[model samples]
Target: MQAGNLVLLLVALGAVFYFFGWRRSYAVSAPLGGVRHLHSLPGYYASLAAVWCVLPALALLGLWLIIDDAVIRTNLMASLPSSIQPANEVDYNLLLNQIRNVAGGALNPAFVPAEVVAAAEQLVAMQARNQQMMSIAFVSIAVLGGVWGWSRVQPRLRARQQVESVMKWMLMGSATVAILTTLGIVLSVLFESIRFFQKVSPVEFLFGLQWSPQIALRADQVGATGAFGAVPLFAGTLLISFIAMCVAVPVGLMSAIYLAEYAHRNVRAWAKPILEILAGVPTVVYGFFAALTVAPAIRGFGESMGLTVASESALAAGLVMGIMIIPFISSLADDVITAVPRAMRDGSLALGATQSETIKRVVIPAALPGIMGGILLAVSRAIGETMIVVMAAGLAANLTANPLEAVTTITVQIVTLLVGDQEFDSAKTLAAFALGLMLFIVTLGLNVIALKIVKKYREQYE
Candidate 1:
């Protein structure tokens, strides 16, 4: 059986074990007159049995999957002639890929050396044998665990405590995995960024004001020089984000206020969903909209007003991006505004304040922290948008503050740098990691500032 099928079978066996454990609990309790005489409920006994039946088997299955490929590769290399043995990691990877392709029938064996053909056959046979052994071991362990758990089910058994302990450990493992994954990402990006800085001076990359990354990594291949300066990218990112915030904050916050405090329940129900649906629209669709419709309209409008707007301008991208992030602010703000105590609204009204005044003074102040968090999220979303910016705000790395001009952001440059086949060790490619690190730093600063604002406002409300 396949590993996935084996997992399904194991789950079915665990369910069967749970039923037996549950029935045994009731049988033991019936002799004592009722379940009240038992240390734990029948359901707890069932859960404990299920956990024992599945957990050990699942653990073994996961371990088997992790090591099986390495074992296969080791045996394959050992069986090969010394002449066929790979001398380095790169050679080994290339040779293994050829073998895999042949084994998978993507490549014909006749095209490769006889040794490769033999290795491909060996690879297939080993995989089949491994799956056979894995399935048998997985099933036997599951059955043994189920029988053991069932045999241990007694009226005095601390099933609830055992099950809860297992659950707590599982939750802790999940949290640890999350923390480690985040740490790994940051370290990887940081290390690569450091490598990039070693190749290019930090001062030139950070402060110099031109943005051309077309220079070849090798001097032999069209290498005049690439400008490593990121000032323009940073300026463009901030300019677009600022414009987006100007559009989103007022519109999203006011709509949130109206929905929470003034709109009829039926109006709110439909309006909120409609607004959220707008948010759920695919970003690629937004990109196309901006490219074809919004950008042209903005340019035309600017020209009509005796302004020289680029066909693909920052204003178009920012405006479309603002519309895209509206639900981020509106939904969160509406929820927080609605969460304010009803008595606060009533007291303000009793003091003869208008409904608008009550909402502004009472509800909004109370919800300021959450509103700030939502705006921060929207700002992040706007800054991170690559498609809309690429499609509308053309990738001209121009360092102008005017919304009428074309500009590009760090994300667009990162995507461009990493898109095609390029030398991984090249400064041009590594520049992506450096830009990513800078973007991360800017986002971290935004979070710190938002948190301080939230903390200050939260104190008054709490």
Candidate 2:
């Protein structure tokens, strides 16, 4: 039978078994003065008894069904004939795939061997019979266990409390999975970065001013050098991130203010989602628009104003990244602003302050922590951004403050390091991990500070 049908059958059998068990228990517990003298309400008592046995037994059966295929496949692999054994790991896996497909009646004509075909047919027949018998046994056990448990239930049983305890443990298990997943990712990144640091000195990687990653391909090659300096890339990253923050913070904050305080209800409803549409645009699309459209425009504008600008400039990339981040800042700012108590706004308005004045002097200061938190998050995004800088900013590592000049960022360098085929142990590849570690540290530091500030603000408000 199909899996769904099997499940339904199990459930139907469980319900029938529960009802019969309830009746048997009730008959046994009936007092001398007929059914009127029974200890509790009949249906509640019945359901309580039924739940103790039916749910647990059925759950176990379902778990078995889910794992049965893996168990059977493992056993079948061990039982395969010595003559048909695979020559290597790859061939073994291929044999297993063929066996599975043939047993499932999904084999193609290309690679069918006569002995393998016979073996598959035999295995399928055996597995089908085995599964059918297992299902029947499971249903029987569920029904019998339900009856047995119901017969044991008494008026003093604390069934509700027992069920609640089980549910609580289930929730804890779910929470543990989520927490473990986050910890696993952090540990993986940390370990790889540690491996990278073993090969290169931390001081040299972090403080050295030049960043040339090309290294010798062979032991005999001469005049090949690899510099692990990270300062220029980080400087470029900071410069671009600062420019992005400059563009995003003011625009996002003002847009948030207008939407939250000043705009008409209809206008706010329509305009907020429209502005947020920018966030949904894919990063790759933004990259090309930065490279093909915005970079040229910036260069042209600079030339028209009697200034020299690089064709691929940091200003263009930062501008586009800032536009990309505006929704992140504005959406978060809007939430925090709206969360500020209406009574505060009313109090400021009652004291003869204009709406703009109240927003600037009172509301904004009250919400400053949250706004700063949003800006920090946007900064982290800017630092981590790769595609826009790769496409628009030139790869030259120049340590300069001028936005008009082309520069490379840590993310751009990381992308270049691992883009095509290369040895994983090489300095070029290891440099990516070092850069990633630094990027993680910087973003983590910002987040910690932001969270602390936000916490303090919340405590004060409360």
Candidate 3:
């Protein structure tokens, strides 16, 4: 049977067990007076039986799928002629892929040697047998588990406690999986970054002024002497992010403040959602707007004002990116500002302070921690944005602070370096990992600072 069909069958069986256990519990309790005399409800017994029927069956199915491919490949290789055996892991994988393609009818048997055709036939037979065995075993186990659980359903079964215990452990397991996944990502990047630093000095990568990353393929190749200096990239990222923050902070905060404090209820209801709709628009759409509309407009305006501007200028990208990130700042700040105690605002006003003065002093100070966190998150979003920067800011890693000139960010270069057929051993490709590590560290630092700010100033009013 197919995996999807088998899963459906398992679900059907679990449902059967659920209803059976529920009715059985009532039947068993009838002789003992009523269901009120039972230790747990009929629903708990039903849930317990369902869990028993599904858990072992799902576990076996998962295990079978994990090992089935390797077992089939091993047996297939054993049946091949000694001379036809693959030489290395890469060749072995290639051979397996060809076999899979042939077995799945994607490749014609006449195009390959007779030995491969024979192996493909064996692969198909083995897969059919494996699926048959797996289906039989899983169904048998699920039925046995259901029978066992149903037989135990009685006045004193303690079904609720058992089901609740299982659910609690499942929830904990889910949390552990999330934490481990995050740790795994960090370790993988850190290890690859270590390898990258082995090829290039940390100091040179961090502090060097030039930003070329092209490694020469031949000694005679001109302008390919790779300079791994990252200063220009860092400077460009900071310059664009600073410009974005400048545009975003005042506008987003003011809008948030107005909605939270001064806006009429009807106006707040409509305007807040309309403003947040900017966040829902895809970054690529924003990128297109930056490239075609914003960049050309900035260049034309600069020309009109007798100022030089790159055709793809950072100002255009930064401005659009700021516009893109406004919702992040506005939404979070609005929530935080609105959460400030109404009594605090009233108390400030009761002391002869104007409404604006109360907001500037009493409300903002109390909500500043959360507002700072929102701003930092917006800044992080600005730093990590790629599409708008790529579309508007040209890929020149110029070490300049001028927003009218073209520049590139670390993320843009990382994408450039690893976009195509990249050899992992090359410094050019490995540099992406190093750049990723730096970006991760920078983001982590920002989070830490935000957390500290929140901790230090949180609940001052309370």
Candidate 4:
């Protein structure tokens, strides 16, 4: 049976065993004092039985799914002739894909080697055997576990304690998995960045102004000694982000204040969702809007005013990106503002303070931490945005503070560097990891600053 079907069967079997446990608990209670004398409620006993019936079988099913492909591939590869065996991991994967396609009838057997066809047949047989064994073991364990739980279901059984303990362990396991995944990603990026730093001096990469990363094919080619200076990229990123924040912060925050404090309930209900609809629009759509519509408008306006504006300028991208991320700030701000205690507002009013005064003095200060959090999230969203920047801001690593100039960000450069079949051995490819590490550092610094601000304001307000 398939894993999905087996899971469904186990769930149904657990339900049945739950009823058995509940009924048995009542029967045992009836002889004593009709459930009043029982150690725990009937529901707890029912849950215990369900846990026993499902958990062990589900564990086996999960284990089987994890290792089933490996076991089948091992058996099939063992049967292949030594002469035709894959020499490396990449070759093994390619051969396995070929065999899988042929076995699934996506490829014709007449077009391939006889050995591969034979291996495909063996693959099919092994999978069928594995499935059969999995189904049997899954069902048997569920049945035996249910029986064990039912026999153990006496008035003295601490079913509630056991169930709660299992739940606690499950939560801990989930938290551990999250922590490990984050650690693994950080280690992977850090190791690759170390490799990149070995190729280029960290001082040159950090302090040099030029940002050309195109690795040359010939020794005599132009820019053969590619400049990996990240200063230009950093300047462009900050310039664009600053422009975006200027547009987003006041507008989004004011709108949020209006919606949360002053707007009628009906007006807020419709307006907030319509405003947040911007967030739901895909980044590619925002990119297209920035490229075709906003960039041209900005360039035309600049020319009319005798200003030098690139066809794709930071101003255009930043404006559209600001519009894109407005919902992030607005939504979170509204939520936090609304969360301020109503009594505080009432108290302020009773003290003769106007609603605006109360908001400026009491509400905003109290909600400063959450407001800062929202702004930080919006800043991260703006910094990480690649599509809008790529579309509207032409990929020029110009170290300029002027928003009218075309410029590129670290994310855009990273995408450009790692777009195709890249040789990881090259400094060009490893530069993406270095850029990623820098981005991580910047984001962490932002979080630290925001946390300190939050802590200071939070203490003062509290």
Task: Tell how far residue 316 is off in model 2, in angstroms.
Answer: 1.2
Q: Residue 210 of model 3: what lDDT? A: 91
Task: Give candidate 1's error at residue 190 in angstroms.
Answer: 0.3
Q: Each candidate's TM vs. the true structure?
A: 0.96, 0.75, 0.94, 0.93
Candidate 3's C-alpha runs over 4 A off are 31-34, 81-91
Which candidate's lDDT is highest?
4
- After aligning candidate 2 to the native by TM-score, how far in Å is the CA of 84 from where it should be? 5.4
Q: Give per-candidate clash totals.
A: 0, 0, 0, 0
* Candidate No. with top TM-score: 1
**Evaluation by lDDT, superior candidate among 3 and 4:** 4
Against the hidden true structure, what lDDT does model 1 obtain? 0.92
Candidate 4 residue lDDT tens string, 1-462: 998899899989999999999999999988887898888899989888888899999899999899999888888888899877999999999999999999999999999899999999988888889999999999999999998888888998888898899899989999999999999989999999999999999998999999988889999999897999999999999989988999999999999999999999999999999999999999999999999999999999999999999999999999999999899999999999999999999999999999999999999989999999999988988999999999999899999988999999999999999998999999999999999999999998899988999899889887
Global CA lDDT computed for model 2: 0.82
Superposed on all Cα atoms, the candidates' RMSDs to the truth, in angstroms, are 1.7, 5.6, 2.0, 2.2
What is the Å distance of residue 433 in model 1 from its true position?
A: 0.6
Residue pairs with backbone atoms closer than 3 Å in model 1 (clashes): none
| Weakest 10 consecutive residues of candidate 4 by summed lDDT | 75-84
| Positional deviation of residue 14's Cα in model 4 after best superposition, in angstroms | 3.4
Q: lDDT tens string, model 3, 1-462?
A: 888898999999999999999999999999999999999999999989999999999898999999998898888988988767899999898888888899999999999878888899999999999989988999999999999888889889899999999999999999999999999999999999999899999999999999788888997897566889999999999988998999999999999999999999999999999999999999999999999999999999999999999999889999999999899999999999999999999999999999999999999999999899999999889889998999999799999989999999988998999997998998889999999999999999999999999988885655
Better of 1 and 2 by TM-score: 1
Q: What C-alpha lDDT, on a 0 to 100 scale, does residue 462 get in candidate 2?
A: 61
Ranking by TM-score: 1, 3, 4, 2
